[model samples]
Target: MKDIYLLSGFLGSGKTSLLSHLIEQLKAEGLKPAVIMNELGKLPFDSKSVDEDVPIKEMLEGCICCTGAEKMEAQLQMLLEGEEFDVLLIETTGAAHPVEAMDAVLSPYFASRLNMKGIITVADCKRWIDRDKMTPQTRMLFMEQIKHAHLIVANKVDLLSDNEIALVTLQIQGLNNHAPIIQTSNAKLPLKMITNLEATYSSQEIQQAAIGKQLSLSSRLHTFTEPVNKDEFEKWVKELPDTIYRMKGYVPLKGHKNPFLFQYAYGMVQWLPEYIKMNPQIVIIGDQVESIAIIGSAQND
Candidate 1:
């Protein structure tokens, strides 16, 4: 039977970072890893980070728990038939509800062929501290993710003060005492710690607990025709509404030779220089995000 692990987290909570690390660790252990990456945008930006040799199936333009569930089953069927992989790692969209995601993955047709490892949830330290500021629906969703996780990764602890870290840890423990919480920077942790975990909840429990309501979040994809001024772009980001939870993709700056990978979550923004030129596009995910305008009159793709 193939081992199956689900990567769960809120927007920009470092799921992809964890996924990359897990892939490397699995490869080092001489195990083959396959990934099924779900994205809210039309393009699969995160899947590009996966190693070329690893077989990947991208579920784009929808959350795995809802519109993409059928696609996910088909992808799983295809992966099972075409690949000889030891483990299957599914990176769910930030907007996905854990129960629903599990229900979708634990299809009766193939459940016997897979060993459900567990859900590894990454919680942003800062986000947890400021979760009260989130919308009621979003806050509930965030809490649900923590409540159902078998192992919780308290990521970005370095950014928080000593006291803040303690508070966040306590709160997480209070929310779900069943799961072991590991505090780390950049979602770094040993592979054995995760791969050995057994699913906390059974497939039947997940099916019974599934919440079928659609989340209010949406995503907008903007493709840039030319490089934009970095300063101007930063200014525009500063003026953005708090409703915009996450923004990420390759962005071309006027002075830079290659586009920089941009990531934004909550109110923080980061830019990492890319050595090679990438397609210039940005995916904005949030409540009512489609109405927002992109810089330089970029058209939505």
Candidate 2:
């Protein structure tokens, strides 16, 4: 049974950067670590930032708190018993609630074996404190990440002022009295602190989730199907605005001879080559996507 560290934070909060640093440092101390990455969108961008040697598993297209988490126990149990690693580091989606995520990991199968070491929430000190007061999307993402972490990391400190930094720290700490907050430029911290920090996510959100376990795992499976005249298919995706969160799949597009592949995360779009090389396939993950529109005549079977 290994100790699992749940690394969660808002988008661009530096969780990846911090985890990269931790991986580098841990190798020096002779610790073998594996990672479970949950992607909010279809594009697997974070994998590029990780080390080449560490084993990585990707959970695509959903928030850990909602549906994708239902698979956590089975997958983790398999990893532990199969890989026999000393440590497990979970990189949750930027929109995750630490408590909810932890609860997902602690389901009956894993609770008996693995112990949760802590919750590390990476906060964009500047964004958390000063990025537009209103949320851009319907999802209450920002608040969820901030509300339930045991360790508050003030990432992207370089973007803030000395005054802004101080105020942000005070406000976050005040909001989360139990958490030990640390300020960092890019999720940087003493490696030892991550491994040894004796903290866990304790919040009403998790308790409430536990009470509604049966209902919480409903949106577990997400599947999209669409068939467009190859030409129109291209237009459909191009017409889609950045507001959509994730979009991806081996989709047939309009006007293209071969199937054109693409994936995007928050307006960051990547169109893969028709030939399979370097993760070639079409995928895009975003907020507002119309399945019926795209899957019009395509036979999923």
Candidate 3:
């Protein structure tokens, strides 16, 4: 049977970054890894970061727990037939509820062919501290993701103070004491630490926990026609309302030869230089994001 692992986390929790690391380590161990990346936007931006040689199936424009559930079963069927990978990693959208996502994956037709590994959740250390500022529904969804995780990765510890780190650790432990929490920067950790985790919940338990209402988050895709002034872009971000939770993609800036990879979560922003030229676009995910404005003459896709 093929081993299947679910990567769970909230928006901007560093799931894709961790996925890249996991793929590198798995390949070094002489094992083949495949990925199924889900995105809220119509375009599959995150899938582009995955290595070219690895088999990937993208579920776009919807969360797997709801509109994309049927597509997931079809994609899983195709992957099982066409891929020769040892492990399959399914990265759900940031707003996806863990129980519903797992239920969609545990389809009766394909369940027997896959060994269900434990869920690996990447918790944003800073987000946990400021979670009270979020809406009641959004906060509940965040807690649910952590509550069902078998192994929790407390990422972005570098941004926190010593006291903040200790407090966040204690808060997460209080929520799900059964799962082992590993604090790290940029979601970096030994591959064995994840692969060695045992399944914590049964199929029955997952069904039981999937009783809450689904979250209603939205996304907007803006394609940049030309490079914008970096300073102006930063100014716009500063003025953004608190409803916008996550923003990520390639953005072309004036004076740069290539577009820089940009990521925003909570209130923090990060920009990394990209050596290769990529399509300049950004995906904004949050509550009522369609009404949000873009800096340049970019059209929503």
Candidate 4:
């Protein structure tokens, strides 16, 4: 059976940074690995950051555990059919729950082909402690991610003092005491240790637990295809409602030969030149995002 690793954590928890290092280490050991990167938004940036010539399947525009479950399974099937890799690593979006993510991966179709190594949850010290600022739903989602992990990586220790680290550790222990906690800044850990982390829960347990837990949360995905004026788009993005937690896509800014890739989260917006040109499109993810206000004139499709 092939080993499958699930990396789970909240947004900005450093899963991607750890993924890059893990990939490099795997390559150095002469082992081939494949990746399934789940993004809550349409445009995927983590896959591009891997910097490895390996099979990478991006399940975008929604969370793999919820809206993108079917697509993730399809991608997994495709990858399994194409090449044989020693192991598979799935990086879940920050909003993904480990139980649901694992449920999607352990579908009966891939039962014999994949053996789950373990679920590794990366907890951002700062973010984990800032629960008071999170919505009730968001806080529940965050706690759920850590509760199902076999190993909890308390990341960003460098950002905290010794006393703070202890406090954070105690808090995590309160939620999950069985999972071994590893401390690191930027999620740095021995690659071998990660590859060999023993799972606390079996795949069967994961599937069973995830059966009805999915219905507890409501997630929605919204896509926009029309291009808007660059200035107007920026203004719209700046004022996006708090209900919309994540947004990503490519936009054709006026006077730019290529469309720019945009990502927004936690009230911050980032835009950069895209190497590949594409029509204007954006995806928004959140709880009940019925619609977004259009800005500026639409460009010709």
Candidate 5:
């Protein structure tokens, strides 16, 4: 059976960064690795970060654990039929609950061919502490992501002091006592830590655990054909409606040759200069985004 690993975490917890690093390491070891990416909106941004050599099946417009499961299964079957891979990595949306995702993966159709390796949840040290201040629904979704993890990674540790890190560790451990915790900045970790994981929960137990709760997020995909002025775009993104919790995409600046990768969680924005060529588009997730005005006169698909 092929090993299927799930990299789950909150938005801006660095799941995509960790996934990219792991994929590269897997390639170096001569292992064939395929990726199944889940995003909350139609336009996929995480897929662009991965290397072209690895095969990817992107589940967009919904989370794999809930509304997107049917499409995800079909994609997995297609990938299995098209190529042979030593392992499969599924990077779920930040909104996905680990137990619910586990239930979907452990379903009968995929159970025979795929092995439920483990769930590695990435947690941001600073963000973990701020969970209490978030909305009730957001807090529940965040808690569910950590509650059933096989491994808990307190990522972005560099931002916190030793004392802060210790407290965050205690908090995460309090919620998940069985899993081992690792500290890292930028989601950097040794490859062996991922490949050597043991399953903490069985499929039967996971199904029993998944009572089937849904996220209350509304998502939209925005596309822009023309290059935009960087400054204006940044301001627009940062000042988005309070309801928008997450936004990510590739944007081509008006005067720049290369495109910029933008990630926004809450009101904070992270920009990275990327070399890959791609169309300018963004996927945004929020509570009610139908009335929000996105920059560049973009169309929400």
Candidate 6:
């Protein structure tokens, strides 16, 4: 059985930094691991920062479940098919839902092959407390990611004083009663914590718990695709409707032969490459706007 770990959190939650740290540890311990980055932008920096120089795979242009779901399974199969590695570390986009991202991995094909080792959720401690600054859509997605983790890594604790640490710990405890919380700076902690981390998914109790009923389970997708030239994909993303919370999957470009990596989180757009597969699978996850414009609350009252 291959060990697979899912790393998820909100925007700027120190996921990349922490991932680099963990990669270092994995290499030092003589483990030849593989990395899968679920990113939003054109910048290909996550590969450079990690120490191991092991194979790094990126799931670009949207949330895992929405757009990158297809490639995710294929990428995993590619890694496991040949020489199977000791473990697989998957880092999800900041705004992506942790449970939904994990669910995409288990979609029929890879369900039996991969082991749901556990989810390690990283939170920007300060940004989390100042939740009011973010839009309702961002906040809603943020809380879902936090609550679903098997272990919540409270990152950027250095910004907080001693007393602030305790307060943050208590606050996270209030939100999630299951997962134990750990504090770290740039994910610089013991590899022991991760290697021995317990799996949170229980097959027996999960059926009784009604997982499908959670979140905006029933969502209507409205795709508005424009022929975005190579140079326009980044700038064009800012113009996407605010109602579109997440946009990703696969998309085409003017000059590029391969389909460009595309994903936008609450208006922030990221473009890049699909080294594994070059096909467009774009999906937009948002509230179905009524009529020509949005008025009052999109939320059903």
TM-score of each: 0.67, 0.63, 0.66, 0.65, 0.66, 0.65
Please identify model 6 stretches exceeding 4 Å from their true place: 200-301
Q: Whose lDDT is higher: candidate 1's or candidate 3's?
A: 1
Q: Provide the lowest-lDDT 10-residue window in model 4.
A: 205-214
- Candidate 4, residue 93: Cα displacement in angstroms equals 0.9
The 0-to-1 C-alpha lDDT of every candidate, in the order given, reads: 0.80, 0.61, 0.79, 0.72, 0.74, 0.65
Q: What TM-score does candidate 2 get on C-alpha atoms?
A: 0.63
Q: Global lDDT for candidate 4?
A: 0.72
Worst 10 residues of 1 by lDDT: 205-214
Runs with alpha carbons beyond 4 Å of true place in candidate 5? 199-301
**Candidate no. 6 TM-score:** 0.65
In order, how many clashes per candidate?
A: 0, 27, 0, 0, 0, 10
Candidate 2 vs candidate 5, TM-score winner: 5
Task: Give one digit per residue, the lDDT tens place, for model 2 in 1-301.
Answer: 5777789877777889988988888788888888888888899899788887887777888877678756675578678777756778899987676656765665433443455566788888777766567566513556556655656788888888899888888888767665677889868888766655542222321111111111111101112233346455556656766544444444444554444455444455566547532221232222222222333433321
Clashing residue pairs in candidate 3 (N, C-alpha, C atoms within 3 angstroms): none
Candidate 3 TM-score, C-alpha based: 0.66
Candidate 4 local lDDT, 1-301, one digit each (tens): 6778889998899999888878888989999989999997778877898766788998878888776867987998899888778889999999887766765675544554565667888999998778889999999988988886777889999988899999999999889876778999989877876755532222431111111112221122222344457778778877877756665556667787777877676788898887877645554444333334445423211
By summed lDDT, the worst window of 10 consecutive residues in model 6 runs over 205-214
Best lDDT goes to which candidate? 1
The per-residue C-alpha lDDT of model 1 at residue 34 equals 97
Clashes of 5: 0
lDDT (tens digit, per residue) of candidate 1 on 1-301: 7888889999899999999999999999999999999999998889999999999999988899887867988999999999889999999999998767865676544654666677788999999989999999999999988987878999999999999999999999999877789999998978988866743222431111111112223334556778899999999998998877667678989989998988776688999999987777665655455557778763432
Give the distance in Å from residue 48's predicted Cα in candidate 4 to where it truly belongs: 1.0
Q: Which stretches of candidate 1 lie above 4 Å from their native place?
A: 199-301
